[model samples]
Target: DQQVKQNSPSLSVQEGRISILNCDYTNSMFDYFLWYKKYPAEGPTFLISISSIKDKNEDGRFTVFLNKSAKHLSLHIVPSQPGDSAVYFCAASRGGGGSQGNLIFGKGTKLSVKP
Candidate 1:
């Protein structure tokens, strides 16, 4: 069974609108959560992250919120732009003693922002 899941395979939003991507995890051991954005033909790049210690983290136009009790997380991109169009992957790790890059990722949700 997949530890992390992105139920929505795709999302579409208009430019200047808010885009929200959702993710869920089955593993309670996950303490670190991250979101990655991938453009066509390019490797996924880290977008935002939130630690279990905090319920939310924000940076610029992007924000990540985590709900430990529900094992859920979400990524929000405000005023979405065409440049924001890409596949977003949700990832989680147990952290602490885990080796580097030891993360479980979701299948990814392709986001298309239209002007």
Candidate 2:
């Protein structure tokens, strides 16, 4: 089964702290990993992504680490701000070979940042 899983349903952190979200996958064929962030009543926005070929990818205050051998991935946000409060989804899919962008997303982890 091609399934993506986010073990934690939610997380809470104070401003200026670090927040981590974890995810797991069972499909060995997946080659691309992505993290999307969503706000209430809004669609998810692409945050960052890492190719299966790489171990890590970073963008601004966000970082993603992928462990292909372990079929696991994580998203880390540092100095979490009040604006960072939102739901985060972990997704995966097969690489560019005619593969439509139909992402398999986890239920999502809601991150709440306290001011």
Candidate 3:
């Protein structure tokens, strides 16, 4: 069963535009959330993250919003650049002391930033 899901398989955006990616989860135990960007034939690299306690978090052009009530989250990238085009994955982990923090990942959303 998929604990996390990305309903949109792909998203297309113009360079210098905003790219919004969405994710949903059924497990309430997830306390920590993260977004990862992946390139072809490579491992996913950490992008952004938000704790359940925060409604929103931002860094530079990347922003992550968490709505615990709805078990939903989204990633927003402002002024999306061509280099930003990649597959984005939504991941969650149950955080606690001594926890390995295994991440449960969504299928992923392929983002295309057109110039």
Model 3: lDDT equals 0.96
**Where in model 3 is the C-alpha error above 4 Å?**
97-100
Least well predicted 10-residue stretch by lDDT in candidate 2: 94-103
Which has the greatest TM-score?
1
lDDT winner: 3
- Per-residue lDDT tens digits for candidate 2, residues 1-115, read 5399999999999999999999999988888899999999999999999998899999999999999889999999998999999999999998554654568999999999999
Instruction: Compose the digit string of candidate 1's lDDT tens values, residues 1-115.
Output: 9999999999999999999999999999889999999999999999999999999999999999999999999999998999999999999998666474499999999999999
Question: TM-scores for all candidates?
Answer: 0.95, 0.93, 0.95
For residue 84, model 1's alpha carbon misses the true position, in angstroms, by: 0.1
Clashing pairs in 1: none
lDDT string for model 3 (68-92, tens) is 9999999999989999999999999
CA displacement after TM-score superposition, residue 74 of candidate 2 (Å): 0.4
Count of clashes in candidate 3: 0
User: Which of candidates 1 and 2 is the stronger one according to TM-score?
Assistant: 1
TM-score for candidate 3, residues paired by index: 0.95
